[model samples]
Target chain A: MDPSEVEFLAEKEVVKIIPNFSLDKIYLIGGDLGPFNPGLPVDVPVWLALNLKQRQKCRILPPEWMDVDKLEDVREMERKEESFTPPPSPYYMELTKLLLNHASDNIPKADEIRTLVKDIWDTRIAKLRLSADSFISQQEAHAKLDNLTLMEINTTRSFLLDSLNCMFKLRSNMQPGSGTGKALDY
Target chain B: MDSQSYLPVPPGVGMEENFLSLDDILLSHERLPSRTECLFPRLGYLEKTSDSQDIMEGTKMELPLWLAKGLYERKRRVVSVELPKVYREGWRTVFSADPTVVDLHKMGPYYYGLGSQMLHFDSPENPEIAQALLQTFIGRFRRTMDSSQNAYNEDTSALVDRLDCLERVLFRMGQSGLNSFQGWEKGRASHLTTSALVLNYRKRKMADLQA
Candidate 1:
């Protein structure tokens, strides 16, 4: 699929999962301040979908017009900033755990679960645009559970685990050091 | 020598009706100095009652004179200030010359000033009259409760309970007073009449908001 098409699909996927998600903003990190270099790897925008606590849960997207074959070179560009430990992607870690847990249960409601996860991600993205202060720790994320009704608590837990599992599986499928490679080891 | 052996009435000491009308009771010079004095008799009455009871019962309940004077003066001022706005123009025009009289009309809305008499008045002999006096207190308590925004809080709940107790005491007094005179009915009728005034105030506020 075209990189733009993939980004668009990913954005849609995020909204489909999380209710009350807005798509006006996405966070981007690590890129050269020059013209697009088709010869060398182009930069990618790291999309972190977050919940109210700003805990993120989505994969990074390559810059516009970049081909998949250039995915290897794109990964190298990201590695330069990899040393800084781009604040543990609360987005990826959370969503991946949720999806993985859901998939393990062999639940038929995986699609429903995915939708809520996406809604949360989209909300996070919208919040980031409105607020740079995105990303919350697990403790803060769990604290949010207190505010949820009893029913929401149970459903959200399962949904979160399922999303996390799916992200992990997607990471394993992609080649190492590829554009959509595994998130930071931590 | 038994108290129960005594006849209902000693023929010579007949009970004379002191049938004071609302105007007579409130405006009488015999019990009070005048209309202005009647507006704040609770201040002096409380002092005298406290001192006499202290001497007879061997316990001082009388507040210090300075404090008593300060409280009475403050209460009088509050009543004098509010009475004019609350009372009809005609009622106030009568006492317009006397600033103290005008003050009484101005502070009429704060009937709680008289209601505060519960803080000091403690005559066990006139328990019936004392209970009737509590009606003014209960009225003030209810007004304060309804006017406050956060009446649901713990502190407010305690205050409300105290107010309710005062109301119950007043109701008991009303029941007892009914045996003597039909006048208690008129006083009871006027208790919640101020609610209409408050409702009108609220409507005006809403109109102002829309404007």
Candidate 2:
């Protein structure tokens, strides 16, 4: 899938925003939005939050996990673990990029948070590659991808799947008649 | 990614060849060393080295893989296909020692495809040959994966120099995945873009006008 499409999915994640203008409770398809009062925080999807923040109609409250200290802890835990640790959020990478890019004014230590998140991402990708290599080398039939975020998986999906397919075909060549007789593989 | 009119058929890496795959077609054309088991009455023109009207029995000649495959039989050998030099014991040892060092592009560009096809002919070392083919791929896979994924927005001719045709396909897949993700990270993928088909169509019209 396209990275932009993944980003679009991330936009559905809700965030807290404080509006400067009062609006009567707006009802819509997904759910009721809110009676957004000036200086009062209301939960809204990232798409609407970014739109309101862009119009100078609201102040975006960065997610609780977006703090630099918390991310530093997550980064440390990620480096110490061999397997994937649960991510801060399913769309952490996308949310971090979007929020920091659009609402850095409200997010304290935005630059530091960006760097920490990037470090965590790099660490996770390295572990992912390492595990993939072992999985191929051992010729294992299946693997569970626990705690891997969509953005992370999207980066390596094509390469990993293609290699696995090639390896399977090459391995099947070992049996004299198996290559042709194995109609079930398709 | 470059715009293609249609998806090209992928090479079948094992014994069965894809009928429409361009790679498989070229692979079938690769010459194999063979010896005629019986005499040919009027097919002497095929043997350019001799002036005889009939090809003598046991006449050694090179035959394309398709022709060799058709004539070869177990019970009565009309023709005998020899193992290609690269798949013989000497090269098999080299591959077993370390597959990553050898240049498969210079060797059989269709290394995996042809190697699998070689299995059709009965030989004492058939098992060894198959083992070596699988091992060679397994040994060289890591380098192919790493180089393809890491080399972004740069000339990849050097990176792909030693890769076999099959490995090259894997490399291209890796590159596309990496390129798309990198483009999105730089905030470039969100913009509205013209389809590559439309852009190429414009170029085609310009070429027609010039002609």
Candidate 3:
């Protein structure tokens, strides 16, 4: 599997951690982590943070956009536009899922966050379906895409390519019948 | 919540693959062996039986699943040569206590589709073969997602490669009309879009910086 957008976001996303113990700098494959104080908050990638949270060794501070109202606003924008700017992180859904799965207690209004994310996802998916419908109907070789994600691209790729290839094959087949090629063969 | 446990199983096509075209199959590096040799010779008359007409004493023949099963039932052990080392290992792993990741692509989608067609014929004797492959595939897929989730601190290229491979597998699965990936669809889709957003943001940021 390719590195998902979520993975990219997760790598870049820094989480505030209140560690249970002080430790020297730890080196990870991607980068290095610093010496920690017991009470002091240090930044770490969301992936490491989630692992620590799961281990009950540290507390993770959720990102700014994780709030219910903000997510609702983003959802509203998504619903209004054919393709609008997405929320801050590509890893938003994955992060939400991970945090909710591993550290729900650490997040305030976890239930509300879940509901809002679900609503946004549904709305966006519906829009994507509509776009895909139009894309199919248009039957053009090319179409401008707005705010298309890798998921939507992956979903539509085979269908689009197959349809286009079929259309081209049909066209090529028909051209032989309509032209001098038939007469030459005869 | 393990969302997978709650997914509505999509309607399964019993013995047909309609999603992929012949061209797609041909283009892909998926092919059955040119010839498959039968290990166990005919007990009665190799030359006399109606079903054994295709069988020659020494030469290998690439028999279809139906013919192969008919021969097998009659005690002609058609040696299964098409199954790759990975699949054999995967099958063994499914039986073992700890099963590692199985590369479904290496097993090949067309090959899997072929095997699925013969499921009805093969299942009576070896009931677990097909089910184990399917279950292990799902498990591996779930693990792929989990790995992606945990890959934040990993190299970007490796992560991208994993995601790219995943997208391909997901596409093939879609072609098969298998609802198995339903559980991961929302998350996968969301992850893709999120990446697009990040790219767009980065591009805009670069433009601003240039300005």
Candidate 4:
């Protein structure tokens, strides 16, 4: 899966925005959104929020956990633990990128948050690679991918699956009669 | 994942060869050292070393794997296939000791494929050979995985130079995964790009047109 595809999925996640102009509650197929009032925050999908932000329609309220102090805590927890801890949000990486890229002005300590997220990402990726190596070396049939995000899985999916497939084929070769019988039948 | 102009039929990396696979076809052409258990009359031309009208019984010579496989049968025993040096005890020890050191491109490029195919012939060393192949793969896998996943946005020719064809395929798989993720992380995946098929497809040159 593409990261953009994952980001597109993430765009469906709801975020808070305060629109300057007043508008009545708008109904959509997904759900009812926004009885926008000046200085009053309303819940809307991230795609809509970004669009509104771009047009100078509203000020996006970064998610509760988007703050640097919280992220720094998350990073510390992530580094201390051997396995993954629960992420701040399922779409933390995507949301960080989208919010920072489009509306850095609204997000306080944007640079610090960016660096912390990157550090967290680098640590997680390193753990992911280490686990993948052990998985391959030990010849584990299946592994439970706890706390791994879709984007994280997407990066290693092809490589891991292909390696497993290759390993399976090579392992299957150990029993000569299995393939030999099939060969004679052919 | 990137799409190619054609979906290549992957090699039948087993004792059984896939008929349509180009790798299997090429593998079939690999020569095997063999000794004939029976005579081949008027087929001495097949053996350039012999001037006789008929190939004598018990004569030893090299034959392509396809020809050898066809001529060999356990019950009839028309020919006997010898284990390749790579599959013998000496090389097996070398492989088992450290698989990463040996450059597989210089050895059997189809090391695993050919090794699997070797089992078709009845030989005392079949079990050992099979074990060696599996062990070698398991041992070399970490290196292949590390290099494939880590070497991003760089010239990979050095990393790829030592890999066998099967490992090369796995390496490319890893590379594509890494590259796609890196591209996405760099915020380029959102941008529209031309399909590789369209990019590679173009009109022939004037020289070709004239020819």
Candidate 5:
């Protein structure tokens, strides 16, 4: 697997243990994992976190930024911003998707978080589409952007690049003497 | 000219006629040899022995970005990735001079894409470095175009106009460096056993050589 895939998994929510029996510290190739106790919470990779949750050995703590109120605030901010706001984490969107799919049972207010994240995503996408429209209409040859998260850029890349490339062709063709020098130009 | 034969074939059809396709540009760019020192501990998955290293922790070994990224992500303790020499020097030049006068394409099409991807994840604090560089570059680029006092003949000016259009497209495209490795491309590579085959077949082929 690509390292990014592994890193994405590593950045997920830390799992909290609700231990039934005592366990010794376990070591893995990556690093020492735990001296797991009855009520201690430790950050863990998503794969291990999900495994522990399934075995009833641990309860996962949703990331601090994953709360319903926080997400709603982010959604509102995105709707109002002229440009993108930096996401809480570079992998915020992906982390949300992973947790929702694999550990929803452990999350507090999973449904609301889902909705809020969706709203934020939809609003930002709508903003991107609007900016693209204005760009084409105004025939501004260049775009200036800041604060876009990695995920937002990924979602808009195809549409943005395709439109810009199309505009490039349009601008070039509209030039005089396009086809046959003085007599013709394509 | 026959009016009946006139057809709107669109303009700028020849814009890239003499230039390499995006895919080709990426392929040749990938062929360049480079290396970087790893500043963290990383695990290595050995394909042949199928035996993996528990950790490669050090600043001693120099490796490519693909390998370095894997190790870095597994346990960022494994290796620290650095900006390669070509780009480091290129930026030094851009920063020291009027960015507008610098040719954005001097480093090649893959410069922004590869540079941003390597830096963003590995060096989180500077994720926006690529965009900042491009913003300055385009600012100056546009300024030069606006200030030109009929610097070239009509033919040359037309070519310059086309180049301006191309530069913008590339700059914007470069902003989303990681996009090239994600989405449709990722989907294609998901079939791990066949991905190598797919890549080989995807390369451009030229035929018809006569002595």
Candidate 6:
């Protein structure tokens, strides 16, 4: 077999495997974006493409997985993202929506989130900074981790889930409102 | 009792003549001394005949209580006790007690006003007196310096230096007094003034030390 054909077949196999695996199970294999044959199989690239066929569906349907919008919409969307989102009880689709919107805007909600996390992280960092011996003990580490703010940790957890969902939704050829949703396994 | 008998007696007949001519009789006449003669023998005729004439020669002396107390207080040994009040009272009691000891012409203004003088300043003639005054001043200064808490650490060096300078000046004054002035009469005023100036400098130095 030709090396290029083998490579292409491997990529196809990886794409096939993406839908069967849950979002959490599908690792980002390589490159800045993800495991790729140029782009994800469905929603993300189609949503990203500027051409009319791709652009029209994105504008009309606005995939639940696609996050980016026009440059003018960026600031307003970022402001919405920063405004407080109360975590849903037992974590629901609405909480995922909030996290997806925040991550999609790509407007350093991480830094804002990090700042929010700082109060939780500060005592740990201070102890680390002061500790004469370089490494933190396991008990100290666990104590610090336990002390992390619920809202901050929750937001981070939701963001991770949203990212995984995007990867899954993109790879699996899932369209918006498609009811293949298996209870958002992990 | 007769008017004619009262006339001046014959040269040797009257009692006055008898008393003068009868010196031996008069000497024998006083078996007991006369009351007036015994009380004030110096004032009476006994002064003329007293064997030790020098004992009755000069004026009598008695000291009033205030003068005695003032002298006792103003004594050199007692000056430490007196000096504070003396300084406070403008050295008036000190001057009154020993006007000769401390020359008023030089030290007068510190105690009293300069009167009508154009240039009013302290005068000291003896350097010893000046040094004594300086010592007293430094003593008071040290007392104040010890009690005071303000900037004591910072002022310590400057205070010590100024005190040293004061001592040097006082010593110089003393040396000059000894070298130039012989009698208290010439230098008394200058000595007194110098002493007062030393005291004033000491006060200023003390205030600085306190600060």
CA displacement after TM-score superposition, residue A49 of candidate 1 (Å): 13
Give a tens-digit lDDT track for model 1, residues B1-211.
0112222321110011123323222321211111122233334445454533223322224332123322334233311112112223453244333322223223432222222222222223223322222322222322332223122222433333333222222223322222212221122321323443354453357767789
TM-score (all chains, Cα) for each model:
0.16, 0.94, 0.46, 0.94, 0.43, 0.12
Q: How big is the positional error of residue B32 in model 4, measured in Å on the Cα after superposition?
A: 1.6
* Each model's lDDT: 0.27, 0.89, 0.50, 0.88, 0.50, 0.26
Q: Tens digits of per-residue lDDT for model 5 on B93-137?
A: 564465545454444344434443344233443424544434443
Q: Write the per-residue lDDT of candidate 4 for residues A1-186, one digit (tens) a residue.
A: 767889999999899999999999899999999799999999999999999999999999999999999999999999999998888888889999999999999999999999999898888888898888888778889998999988788878887887787778878877657877655542
Residues A73-156 of candidate 1 have per-residue lDDT tens digits of 323333433122221122332333333332323233444444444444334323322221111111122222222222122212
lDDT of 6 by residue, B1-211 (tens): 0012122311121111122333223222212111110132343343444555333423233322122222222113211111223333346445435333443223421221111010111112222233233333323232222222122224344323333222222223222322221222122222323333344453357767788
> Best-fitting candidate, measured by DockQ?
4
Fraction of the reference Cα-Cα interface contacts (below 8 Å) that each candidate reproduces: 0.00, 0.76, 0.00, 0.75, 0.00, 0.00
Task: Give model 1's DockQ, 2 decimals.
Answer: 0.00
After superposing candidate 1, which stretches have Cα over 4 Å from the reference? Answer: A1-55, A58-186, B1-129, B139-147, B150-211
Encode model 2's per-residue lDDT on A63-163: one tens digit a residue: 99999888999999999988999999999999999999899999999999999999999999889888888888788999999999999999889889888
Question: How does model 4 fare in lDDT?
Answer: 0.88
Per-residue error (Å), model 6, residue A171: 63
Q: Against the native chain B, what TM-score does each candidate's chain B reach?
A: 0.18, 0.93, 0.40, 0.93, 0.39, 0.16
Clashing pairs in 4: none
Tell how far residue A161 is off in model 1, in angstroms: 47
Ranking by TM-score: 2, 4, 3, 5, 1, 6
